[model samples]
Target: MRRGAGIGAIRNREMVQAKYKEKGAEMAETQMATLSRQLAQLRTSLESFAAKHGTKIKNDPEFRGQFQAMCSSIGVDPIAYSRGCWSEALGLGEFYYHLGVRIIEVCMTNQKRTGGILPLNELVAQLNATKSSYASEISTDDVQRSIKKLRCLGTGFMLIHLAGGRTLVQSVPGEMSMDKTSVLGLAETHSGQTTMSLCCQEFGWSEDRARTALNQLVQEGMSWVDDADPTGERVYWFPSLFQAVRSSG
Candidate 1:
């Protein structure tokens, strides 16, 4: 009715929009400042907690786990601090560094047999065996955390999740083809032995495809050829599973 919107009205609307944008920016800045203060407080609190319980954190795995969880909840990484107060209070930097070294040593020591793919349980057992009886026991959580930190080295220190709730650590950096990994799954489920026929039947793959996958793994030294089968077919056994299969048998 008032000649639709006049130029003056449009100018007024623009001014209102500009004001809202300014306010929004101010509010965002305020929120960010508040968050920064909160984070500082959280870090201070964690530091105090660590300083008070430094001994327990060093000697008690459970206490250390709880402390770590608290730090993780706030996006804090004690291990990253590597030096200064946090490291001194938590002992995280030195402890995990040493643990990471031990883990890699174990993996390297058994690399020939495992092809750098070792089961998590075996790794833990060998590691603890190397530790003094007076030393605190290392848990899987500890190994996993240490490995996570070791990933920066780019050596492919990663945990592989496979079928049947089995976790394997891949210490050597290598590519795992889909077909080969699938065949490994079959091996894991069948007492660590998978043959050409089994792979073909399980994955509905062609004979050539199955053979290629099995052969690839064998070439990688991850699989051993068991040619003594009564059926005359070569059984590809996973070295990582030999101990388990043998113990079970």
Candidate 2:
């Protein structure tokens, strides 16, 4: 009788555990179904909203920027016209394609001058100065999106969010060295100019360490050497600061 009772108890415990496992599996399946319905609803709502505001999204840079942000929040790339279905519904393929070509042209045409790392302001300024097929005015947000699309193609386009409101666009493919990057950051504080002493003073780097970066920039046409500083310390000016200086002037 004792043996029979023990076996019955073990069987009851197994039955309870089996029921719990079945309940958990059913709950998981129901939750997944609910999530799928929510996602489908979200996609439909986005499509409807985009259809209503299609003109503003295509013609106005600021409006387009906001629209892109909305799409991004939901992990949607409606502006990527190269991808099939979104391109047809939004009709923004030509606009982004034109803007992307223009960006590439601007970066390539001026690479010799700015070493392919352009200030976002300068890029926007240049983009607006010309007549683009799709846009009358280009915003930083638009430029950034276009760059993001270009980057997906495995190109070298990159955005650098610098301190303050300044942004940099690197058009080339190579990864910038840490030393060179630090030097550029330091130049941002001193009206786009820095020297070995300033770099050393700010970063506590040795003279040799400073020159290695500054000299490479100078050689790459990114920085212009000015031996005429009144303090007698050689100054390296970043061409990347052109738009900011011009706007202030």
Candidate 3:
């Protein structure tokens, strides 16, 4: 009888525990539902805000940057999609989408000269010169946002950071060697042209070292040989930078 009683107590305890477990699960589910609803409401409000201020954000670079910051704070990407949720919410999807297409075109046309990398400022200047209809209002922020959307195409569009808080657009697929990167950085500092003497004087490199690096870049089509330089010194120019300089001149 004692054994039977103990078994009954065990069963009773299990039943009680099961009841408590069910109650806990119910409470958790209720909490989760409440949180989900709150999040949904917050998202609705944010969408409304984006729709209302879409025009200001699209037209003014400063305002657009601030809006982007706010979206980021909420873990949102205002320009992530070319259509659907973000497009309907912000109404600026088409603008960035079209800009991204143009960016791809520009990058492809100059790929041989730039070796798939070009400074952000140079890109903006070229885009403006080539597409004058919206040039006056275009800004780096707008271009960056547009480029961010381009990543979805898996075309390997990326932004690279340089030594001086400068950024460049890299539209090609390969990792650049350190020597090549350094050579390009040096070229940027000297108006896109660098000679063996300049590299040796500026970076304390040997003549052979500078020449080897420059030749590699030339072979890879990242730079152009200016053997016909007026000074008779072999000058190598990073084409993207040289293009910008030529445009301004």
Candidate 4:
């Protein structure tokens, strides 16, 4: 009879512990839901802030430096903050998120130019130009660091090198201009199906830069990923341009 009583006591204790664990799990789930909602609110706020100040931030070297400095002051990595906020709550791929931000910035640059994105070459030119003057203020290391962080956040940028010593940089969808002729003419000739690495080698661009640019192009729909290559190299062949050419022809 005593053994049976002891067994009953053990079973009661187990039931109590199980109840506590179930309550704890419920509390945890509630907290996670609240946190997720808060994160979404934060991302909306950041996106508004970016829309209001992205161009200024991109163009003014001093301002960009000061902004980075300010991020340092607050003990925060601004790029990481921006990217993290998007990734955690939104379930967006980093490349798409970054590309989306870039597209919005381009749209904000001109409302009428909406839907007519800038070409990869022009975008790269702008980035390089900004980098040139901003180089002294912001090191290549910083840019590379930011790039790495952005990639982690799932955002990617592309850098294109063309013949005659020109480099073009652009983000995806937000800035792919349909009207301009790519200096490489690969986009014009191949119908947006050419590999970026091949274009870079043909144009003598740094392999790393070319790869990044090609990836961006693929994301933006200016180019397509080469299924033939197991490694997933991107090729641009003027898919947009060909459509236009077909219409004209």
Candidate 5:
């Protein structure tokens, strides 16, 4: 009787273990399915964004190369990166479309010169007219948000004050041009090394300041540092900086 009871208990334990194993497998499968769906949604969004922008973002070499490098470093597929670029371009295109419509209206009404550029006041009036048509769409708040987004993507406009009370809004080209010195400093400090703190100590900067500058450079595509240091130190380098150094010599 004792042996029979013991055998029954052993079989019950085995059954419980098998049930737990099946549940674990089901959970893993469900998680994978969820991830797959999310990725699909992201891809769709990216493609839609690109489609809205026309061909400018798709064909821009500098933009494409920087985007590809960043995406590759972070393990994003090349196709996905292309889609993201398109999406970003589409957003900018929408703003430009509105602006272009206003410009055409202003040019037709005020200026007899077809090819010659108009003055700053005329441009501002056109922009204002455009803003008025889509007042709900082009509020001050929206402009601020758009500017922030553009800055993140390394594109922005600067208001330059010219002679005789004129202001011109010009596009700032290339991330490197805007932040060259700081980017070079970061690349120099982190080249072939990791851990901004160690670099900071070697270069006589506070750890916090060094980290901030280094992170900014990394975001701007001038340098890169690994997130993890299982090997006891971080590593950093800038491919562009290396090329520049080689070319100069």
Candidate 6:
């Protein structure tokens, strides 16, 4: 009788465990269903929003940047698959893809002068000046979006943030040394040009140390030497910084 009781207790325990497992599975399924519904609702709302502001988002750089930010917040890539629900709704995918192509052309065209690194605004300006059918509508945001797509082509397009709120689009594959980067930052702070004396005064570096870093940048074609300074001091002008100055002027 004791043996039979023990067997019955084991059966009861197994039954309870099986029931709990089944309940957990059902709960998981229900949660998944709720999440799916939420996602569907989000997509529908996003599509409606995109459709409503499609033109403004496409033609205006500021508006487009804001829209991209919104899409990013929701984990939506409007241009992810070229042509899909989001693209069909907003027509942004085709716009950015074409812009991406034009960006490659511009980068290749100016590679000699800029060494695959140029001011983001200047790049946009050149792209708009290309007289391409969509050139008139191109903006900095558009250029940035297109460059994001160009990463797939292994083109090494990247955005660099320099001092003084300057941005550059880099299409080359190279790492800037710390000293070079610091020099660029210093130049950015000084209207895109840095004199050895300024560097020495600011960083307390010896004349030789300051000259070596600035000279390295000039050697890499990343900076231009300006011996025409009224102060009779050679100044290193970072091209991207110069580009920013020109645009602002």
In order of appearance, the predictions have TM-scores of: 0.90, 0.84, 0.68, 0.33, 0.31, 0.70
lDDT over C-alpha atoms for residue 120 of model 6: 82
RMSD of 2: 2.8
Off by over 4 Å in 3: 1-42, 81-86, 112-115, 129-136, 196-213, 227-234, 246-249
Off by over 4 Å in 2: 1-11, 81-85, 132-136, 227-232
lDDT of 2: 0.81
Deviation from native of the Cα of residue 14 in model 5, angstroms: 0.8
Best by TM-score: 1
Give the better candidate number (1 or 2) by lDDT. 1
Q: Sorted by TM-score, highest first, which candidate order results?
A: 1, 2, 6, 3, 4, 5
Query: What are the Cα lDDT values of the candidates?
Result: 0.84, 0.81, 0.78, 0.49, 0.48, 0.77
Sum up the clashes in candidate 3. Answer: 0
RMSD of each: 2.1, 2.8, 5.7, 14.8, 18.5, 4.9
User: Which candidate number has the best lDDT?
Assistant: 1
Q: Per-residue lDDT for 176-205 in model 3, tens only? A: 667777777777777878888888888788
Minimal lDDT window, size 10, model 3: 80-89
Name the TM-score of candidate 6: 0.70
Name the lDDT of candidate 3. 0.78
Instruction: Record all residue pairs in model 6 with backbone atoms less than 3 Å apart, i.e. clashing.
Output: none
Candidate 1 residue 12 Cα shift, in angstroms, is 1.3
In the range 54-172, model 4's lDDT, one tens digit per residue, is 55555554565565564455354555464643334322234234434544364245323212333443433334554345332333323433434544554444443433343333333
Measured with C-alpha atoms, the lDDT of residue 71 in candidate 4 is 48
User: Candidate 5, residues 74-103: lDDT per residue as tens digits?
Assistant: 455443233454545544445544544454
Model 5: which ten-residue window has the lowest total lDDT? 110-119
Which ranges of candidate 1 are over 4 A from the true structure? 1-5
